[model samples]
Target: MSNVVAAAENSYLAAFDQPGRATVEPTPRPGWRQAARDRFAELGFPTKRDEDWRFTNVGPVARTEYELAVAPAAVTLDQLEPWIYPEMARAVFVDGHFVAGLSDLDGLPDGVRVGSLAAALEGGDVTAHDHLGRYAPFDRQAFIALNTALFADGAFVAVPAKTVVERPIQLLFVAGPGERRMAFPRNLIVAGEAAQVTLVESYVGLGTESLTCPVTELAADPAAVVDHYRLQQERTDATHIALQHYHCERAANVSTHSLSFGGGLVRNDVWAVLDGEGVECTLNGLYLTRGRQHVDNHMWVEHVKPNCNSYELYKGILEEQSRAVFNGLIHVHPEAQKTDAKQTNRNLLLSSDAGVHTNPQLVIHADDVRCTHGSTVGQLDADAVFYLRSRGIGEEAAKSLLIYAFARDIVDRIRLESVRTDLEEFLFSRLPKGEIVRQAV
Candidate 1:
């Protein structure tokens, strides 16, 4: 084994040995923790040799020795007020532990359960035991394994059958005052038959340098509708790795939107399986990177039944020596018929040193399937810039306008008004001379 791999293995073993690092009770799935650890030990971390991980390396994560974040830190709502949405129900976690004082769940609808995973388990919520680690299989992925083995706390959301939740549920995770530390967060969401719900998962970091690994599993029953949004806006010096697994049953509708704006090294893995007929799935993402940052997004969609539809669109903006990677795969099984799938990736580079790698693949074993994919990587249109400049717009402002226009395509698709407005404000602030545009708004 390589030295980096060995060092990583040692760190994992040491962390596992620490007291109270793993939270597993005897009543609820006793052997799962051990099974996950064994799986991680067998598979180890992914290297550059792996085709799926060829562009992104895990050496930095593996070699770094980070202590577990266990202590509870004080964080007021004022510190998080800017990011909080007043229209949504909130559940907060700080440094891997749920903080009741910082959370608000007033006026929540009936037939819905929202709280911390640890509390749910202790309260004997059977649904948590039934679907905690089912969708996100840990055997094939090392990061998932690590999360399963060491997860301290996360969010749990369940919508009962035939219920409609009009308001969105927000899961906020904050990392505060811990340097060289790591936290594992796991979430499970289940939408029953004919149920409708929306979820927003946000990760914010206030610490200097830390690492966060989070895994979320979503299951939608027949005729159910589930909308999920993940927003990652951590400290520029922090590292983030996240995984999401979605299962759509017959005639179910599921949509996921991911917006990534901050982090030093970030990787996101999303997988969806359409297991029943007439299902609809939508995946959309936008990522912005600058100042030597690295972001990677990997997605896979599997069509297991007939008459299913899937659509994917991902956009990226890179500047100032930043780098990004996008890898997407659409697979149609032999038994599946009339599967309609479309995938597209578009990227904009602002600086000469900025770089992007995009790959979209389609594998079809069914004769009656329509699958298409495309990818593009380029700089801004000089003609458009010139046209704006000729109209008395400053050069920098012209570039900013073009960049915002390029991003507006993805932003307009967001259904939630509050989320859309927040993202617009955040994106505008990151642009060059963006304060001028903000003033006009």
Candidate 2:
């Protein structure tokens, strides 16, 4: 093993061995924690030698000596106002600890629970313990194992059967002012049978060079409908690693959207398993990178039952010397006959120095399954730019207009008005002369 990976493993194992660390929370299954630590120690940190992490190297993260952040820094609502959505029920966490003063969960519907995971575990909420580490298996992935063993606080949401939540629930995680400090945030969301809910996970940093590792588990029971959004807007010097595991039952519908705009090094891993017949799943993502930043998105969908449907679309806008990676896989089991799956990945490069790697795979064991996958990497269409320039638009404005038009294909799918508006504003600001296109729209 390399020195960097060895150092990282030792640091985490030392922290895990600290007295009182394992008993910090009254989790029903304490053995899971010890097992996670052992798994992490066995696997160590992933490197370029690993097949899944071949394109992206995490040596910088592994080499760094980081301490766990335990205390909430001095921050106020005014500083976080820019990222807050007024229409959603917000739950705030600072430095891996839930802060009640900054959260607003008023007027929630009956039988709906939205709050902190730490509180639920301490208050003896059996539901939290029952579903916390059930879906996200940590034995194979080192980062997931580290998060499962170290995470102290995160969001916990549950929607009872047959209830429809009018407002969305937002879980906002803010990294405070600290260099070389790390925070582990874990979330568990359960949607009962026939329940409907929209949940958002947003990560923001206070201009600090920190590390944020988060894991979220989502369970959608029979006939349930879930819309999940993950937004990452951290400091350019920060490193963000996250994992999301989803399980869909019979006839359940689940859609996830990932939007990433910031972070020095970012990796997002999403896995979904359709365990019952007639399940529907959709995954959508958009990533914009500039400077020397690196972003990666890895997704896997397993069709374990027959008559299931899945769709995936991901797009990237790269500029300067930035880089991005997209890896998607679709697997159909022998029993999963008549499965329909499709995957597409598209990337647009604004600079010749920018780079992107896209891989889409389909593995089918049933002859009746229909699965297709493709990827494309290209630059802006010169003909479209020339056409716009002939119509009295400047060269820069015309290029920006064409780029924005290409991105709108995914933005138009956002159902929430506030989220769409915020995303549009943010995307426009990233272009050279995007104000012209914004005004035209």
Candidate 3:
């Protein structure tokens, strides 16, 4: 038998009693923080026995010792220059705490509130108080429970009824230089009835090898339109665990794009519910991994109302010895007649040792629903590569051209021009003979 050593400093339960948590002063039966802590204590870390996590093991996260990141690190605008978009109103968080000086939110419209969650809580923002932890459930999720129990700060945004936000807002979480520090960021986006908004969340840490766990909750009111994008670009030595929950009301249109480019081990858990009739929900994601990186995307979509439509598409490109997993499920309730849902997951393996595990599932309780699921895992077409090579193109450039073509469909579907351009540039940089790929595109 292999010997295992457990350290008290790394114990989550021991750290819960520490004096510097977000909810240090609290009381009541099953208070928000206490309740989450209790649940997490019961659940602990999931093992391979758990069906949802059987393919991806989180033992590294459970064993690593991390100090709670409650203070903001000194980060200058120059350091954020790479990720910052001058045209977008942005909120910056360093080591889980908001840094007002590094953010820019000028010329925001009336009835729109975007800032740090801690400030909103201290200043008594009614909307923030009413809906902070309303959507992300912590009872059954260990990461969500741990984040809720120990989270100190995050990003909060609220758009009022009938308003159109002309400027896109960005919430950037930066994990600064540290020795295995951990940060939990909780974000909430609330769009009122008939409102329209575009929002982006970015997690970027250039060289920091920290652990970041974030939970984001979004609610789209009746007839509202919400366009959301999430970008994860942490260092290759870091670990990231994230969860997002979205509620789509009657006639609301909600679209979310998840772009993951970096991190050593990453887990993305996403769930969306059609809460009312005539709702439209779309989920799209792209992930690229090299080296020994491992990435997993788990999605659960529920249709609770009739006449609602949901679409899911996720694609991954694995190189070297990298690995990836995609688990998508569409659950249709008995009353969800006329529900339409389609799920697809595709993977491209650039190396013989690269691997992928994809499971697209459908659980239907209604006979009138239309649901379909499909997955594909394969290597590049040899004849296509040969044809490109025969056309006087170098082997690497020819391969890059084909790779670019494979990913073009998803990137072209993005409506946000600036984000699309940046992602295109990013994709180009990752390809071999990337300039040839860009010119060919």
Candidate 4:
């Protein structure tokens, strides 16, 4: 084992021994638990040298030890309303354990199962071993391995065949204040054949200091349709690392959105696999950062079969001395014919000190595939800003309008009105208003 592995093991052992960490009483399971622990021991965390992780570094994270997240600490609705979306089925996880009292899953449709991974595993309602940790590259990420070995609570959703769930299900993972919280917030969303549903997973942190490590896996069967959204809003002193993988079968449709607004250092790793013909996939994201924060998004979309289509668009705004990175790739395998894929990444720099790196890459092995990727990093359009100012719009308002317009394309693509509205409101709150532009003019 390498020094990195040794360090991770030491951290894990220390975390397990700490009384401050929440006691994870995963329902009594002998075989599955042992298997998972073995798998974790065999695989350690990944570093920047790894090919897929070359763009991001985990050195700072590796040195620090984090306990799994715990339940919210007496926070009122007014304190959390900004993080919660209205009218959605809510599932709450605090300190890495599901909080039944705070979660509301009363009106779910028939045949749809929603609960903690531990509860589901204990109840024998779902096979924890069948799909858990099955898709992620365990060898590459030490954090992933740690999560696999230690994840005590998670969310599981099952939609029956051809069933259409009109309402969206919300999963909220909260890491309360002063907690060395580490949570493997796993989400297994299996959409049965021809089934349709929408889900939103929101990660929030209370208090000043917290940590969240989350992994989610989503699978869609043939002809199924699913929409997934990941929203991250935590305290400024918080740290977060999340990995999401999506598998789409023949003729299936999968759409995912990532919205990030908080954390000291944040990394989001996403991979989408088109495993069958006629599959359609879309990946969209928006991230805004200020202060000394760092946000990284690395994504991959693979077309493994013929006649598939995928689109990716990510936009970001960086303020103050913050930094942001976007890396997206689309791969068309040799067997994939008639594939249509497009990727674009755009960034707006709000401060001269801010740093933004955007890369959109494409690899095609098939002859008859249409694929394109491009990335651009630039400042707001001066002409547009001037036009707005000439219209009697305050300088701050002018800049705000231009910035908002710059991000409108990605926001407008959200098919769900409720989610779209929620996102818009969040964006409005974070963006600079008419004042900043006027000062500049």
Q: After superposition, which runs of candidate 2 have C-alpha atoms over 4 Å from their true positions?
A: 1-4, 18-28
> Candidate 3, TM-score vs. the true structure?
0.96
**Cα error of candidate 1 at position 41, Å:** 1.6
Model 1: per-residue lDDT, tens digit, 1-441? 466476677787677668867466325457887888888887788899989888888788888888887665788898888678878999988877788888888877786888888888878888888878878888879889988888888888989999999889899988877677788888889999999999899999877778899999899999999989999888889899889999999999999999999888899999999999999999999999999899999999999999999999999999999989999999999988999999999999999999999999999999999999999998999999999899988898888888888898789999988899888888788888676666644
Provide the global lDDT of candidate 4 against the true structure: 0.78
> Each model's C-alpha lDDT?
0.88, 0.88, 0.88, 0.78
**TM-score per candidate:** 0.96, 0.97, 0.96, 0.90
**Residue-wise lDDT of candidate 4 within 1-441, one digit each (tens)?**
586566766676555445553333334333443454555565545666676666566666667776544343555556667677768888887766777777788787898887787677667665444556557755556666566656767888888899998889888888765656566676677888999999998888875657677878888989999999888888778888888989899999999988888888898989899999999999999888899888999988999999999999999988999999888889899999999999989999989999987777888899999998888889988898898889898777887878887778988888778878777776677666734533442
In model 4, where is the ten-residue run with the lowest total lDDT?
21-30
lDDT score at residue 55, model 2, on the 0-100 scale = 87
Better of 3 and 4 by lDDT: 3
Winner on lDDT between 2 and 3 is: 2
* lDDT by residue (tens digit), candidate 2, 347-410: 9999999999999988889999889999999999999899988989999999998889878978
Q: After superposition, how far is residue 126 of candidate 2 from its true place, in Å?
A: 1.9
